[model samples]
Target chain A: MSLARLSRSQQSNRLPELLVPAALGTLMLIYFAVPFVAFLTRAGTTNIITGLSTPEAQVAIRNSLLTAPISTLIATAFGVPLAYVLARASFVGKRLVEALVILPLIVPPVVGGAMILTAVGRFTPIGSAAATLGISLTDSLIGVILAQTFVAAPFVIITARAGFGAIDERLEQASRSLGYGPLSTFWNVSLPLARGAIIAGIILTFARAIGEFGATMMVAYNPRTMPTRIWVDFIAGGMDAIVPVALALLGITLAVLTAVQRFGRVPTVIDR
Target chain B: MILELKQLTHRYGDELAVDDVSFELEEGELLALLGPSGCGKTTIVQAIAGHVQPTAGRVVLRNRDVTEASPEDRHVGIVFQQPTLYPHMTVSENVAYGLTARGVEPNQRDERVSEYLELVDLTEQWDAYPSELSGGQQRRVEVARALAPQPDVLLLDEPLSALDRQLRERLRKEIARIQTETGVTTLFVTHDQQEAMALADRLIVMNDGRVSGSGTPRALYGSPPTPFVASFLGRSNTFPATVVAQQPPTLRVGTHKLTVSNQELSVSAGTSVTCHIRPDGLSVIAPGSENGTALSLAGEVVTVTDVGRRYDVTIRTERSDEFVVETVERPPEPGEEITLELPRDRITIFETHDHDRGSTTGVPEH
Candidate 1:
């Protein structure tokens, strides 16, 4: 054979080594993309607009939009401090605390709902105390928030802890040496350096909270969220009934992700 | 004294890291704590900065016992080994951080920041982020940031150890000039002896958690109290010898005899001792041109290395002992025999069994 044809034959012989991984990666990408593409194409824009105008769909949308952000705010305000403590301090039973923080991530969502019920059911001490104050703990919006918080709070804590852990301790020490105390140093140096991770954690927490269903079903089913409303519509009218809410959910999540990604692109501490 | 560390001892678990180390720095003086890595030079700096509380001792700054004080309360400025500029802030903002923490007004903080940036000659890069600057520029910003607060003292921990040789040399001169111009009482910690000798007004040599010697560069290099100090501070050749006589202080090294001055001899007759001679202290003499008072030996040239301004000529003497002589004169070729002269006043003798013997053999060739 000529030299060019001989090299081309050699290249053909070696192509399978590279082809296997490429083919497998394409298969996985198609598997993930096919469902979204099918759903969008099947549910036309006219059908989506009609399904979204119903009163039931409107209530579920309002409840989800309202409760998810409140739950996220609550998780962030408390979870960030806990993550900072876990990252920076050493004490007795610290491993136990860390395991407790990660328990929700490991346990099934329905089991976590049951665990929350055992601690705050209507018959329990805390639930009864709230009942005396004219607040029902179960079958209410508060119950929905409780369920969402239980399943979604861990994302923020774990991601933020990793962020705080990556900061160089010497930078904090430099701040302290320059006449700033620990608390001020945290506000000035530690928090700003860890902003990117914290924002990522917040996004993940909100996404998980809004999509939560199993735990919300176990606790509060009356004040329906988008996921619960979709379930109801599926049972009542099959695939045709649920398509519009699913599309709406996908649209909301995409918008939030895009907005946060734009805002969160500010340079992190170690980007350089 | 601007700062004093008394009986500073620290233990990490059961292992002692710093043992009864004590030193004092005068006002506006730059004192270098010099030693190899893991020798507790850094522990002393941490103790002084209040980052580390000694297991036992007092860290006194400006006559106040700061051992019990928090780092922020101590009002000390520190430049860590890394530049450690806040990556999120601009160069001026990083320099103004301390003043802001202390609640300095915006106008004054800006003025002070500019002044320090000017001092480090980084005024042109005031708005640049640390990542945009060169490594040397980043380090200069760190210096400016530490100095802007105008704390009572400044501590630099191996500030130039991470740079290349040319950059390090330039920064060394820059730091010396900065210390002189600002007159800040500074404690500099370093492992490189040349850096210590070049920048320190006075340096304390540490080895294995204790002070081996402490004095001016000239005093310590001229008369190192221990063999470790002798080798660590500069290049030297050591010979195992015994004092043969006390009158005129004679020493016998193998089969060769040498005489030293009375002031140089501390031990009596027949005491085992180590003799230290700097390479530059020895010179090659022509045949029949020897000075009568200086000790002389005949040796074969082993290697002649031209070190730019001078030649380092290695010689193997009749006793089979090797010595390196630095001279500007033309060097003899390998295997050529020549006579080397050792001046009496240049020899420093240490008792062989001194309590603080270090790991250095004081032989540069090996």
Candidate 2:
């Protein structure tokens, strides 16, 4: 039989086999799409614009805008090196280190915040020292940052680790043999090769940090983030007040995602 | 000597990978490490490149001990088996990487990159990434990259084995030309005997982690010191034989007797020895042809394989010993009885207990 005819006949024979999965997949897609559609329709542009004009909403927007990027920067600056080490080096307790890196992701965000508090609470030595230096570790922007970093840093580390792991070690070896030192080889070969994945991880970290709620609430409730503000709005004024702030939060997140998608085209080494 | 590995040994945990391997490369000499897969040839290359620290022994370059030095400090250029051209870099950038790392002026680096790219005939591909090139083209880029640094010694770890037969042959010639033009001391590692023999000035045959033999390609091919070298180097018909006479130097292969040169027969009479004869060494004597000083064996044609450029005829003798004979002329069919002639000088004999034997019959796949 001709190839086209054979393929068509085979596809037709498999249609019944695909029916269940296709139906299930479409249902799940709709389930995910429904909330976004409902939120967008209910929180009209006028409501969103008006809600975002409120003093509380403005403060929350300012706090989120300021903290998330800083948190993302911190995560990328520290996490990429950790990821590289985990991927390339073998040392004692390496498995434990890897598991610890993923601990923030595994634990509940409130529990993570509580763990952060127990370690650096006002009564603790680090918190008391910071307080004595006139810097409060909790109930401030620093607290918000700590919470967001705790909740979101794992995304970048895990993704960047996977990216570094995919690189051929021989490429680095080749770099070294060509007279580049280990550090130079890492900068010249490893970093550029894993840039695609690291950028992807950065995007995910920023998204998660911006949307972080439970941990942010547990650590710093006064200097409100978008999620915390939404929670307060839901408690005080119900759905009507919550919609605009929620839409504002969604709008900022979507804008960030869109901007990143447009600009940060992840460059990867072409597979041989 | 440009580079010397003295009694180099490396072990991966409890398993030994390279065992007391020692060799030297004279200035601008092309040496090939020929061996089978997992024979630790690549490990030796790594040791020389300073990528792997040898468990014991020193690597001396230009009379300077460099065994403890890092790869970057060694200034040894290497082309890996896989074309490890930095996929993220353009051809020009890849070629200039080493020079840039060495802090050469940008203008000088560009000049050297263009020079080496042109040497590999990839000047037109300077702007292209490695992924845009063919396998052979990528390998050429790797060679250009390795050569642009002007390293004291160049190590190629089976650089062309990944290509097809036609491309491999073409690149092999190009590599030889490039090496000659650069005049850099080079060590080429390969499992294919043909590639080794065709490219190298001298060959080091390795087996299981040790050097079985080392000599000029022609010398190694004609007179391998060990049975592993004989079977691994080229096509050979090896027979388990016993030395029957000392003065005339004769071996008894089953019921047939074959005489060899006295130079290779160091064992005494009645000692067990392995007889090795290349396919081309044995000939089919026509029924009425004169067999002057050539040992003759009467056998039946078992199989004839028409390999390109020649025909390999497998003949089973009356004593059930099989020997393959290669000839340009068409051979008789299977079951046809024939008389095969063995020239005395073409035979090489080794004491059976001297070294471990590889395959006793049939050609090894490359």
lDDT scores in order: 0.87, 0.87
Docking class of 2: medium
Interface RMSD of 1: 0.8
lDDT tens digits, residues B165-228, model 2? Answer: 9999999999999989999999999999999999999999998899999999999989778788
Candidate whose TM-score is highest: 2
Please give the RMSD of candidate 1 to the true structure: 5.1
Residue pairs with colliding backbones in model 2 are none
TM-score of chain A of each: 0.88, 0.90
Error of 2 at B135 (Å): 2.6
Q: Model 2: per-residue lDDT, tens digit, A1-272?
A: 37656676778856566568889999999999998798777766346677789899999999999999999999999999999999999999998998899899999999998888988889999999999999988889999999999999999998889989999998999999988888988899999888878878888899899999988888887699999999998999887888877777777877876677557664321211
* Residue B50 local lDDT, model 1: 85
- Backbone clashes, candidate 2: 0
TM-score of chain A of 2: 0.90
Where does the lowest 10-residue lDDT sum fall in candidate 2 chain B?
Answer: B356-365
Residue B309, model 2: Cα distance from true site in angstroms? 3.5
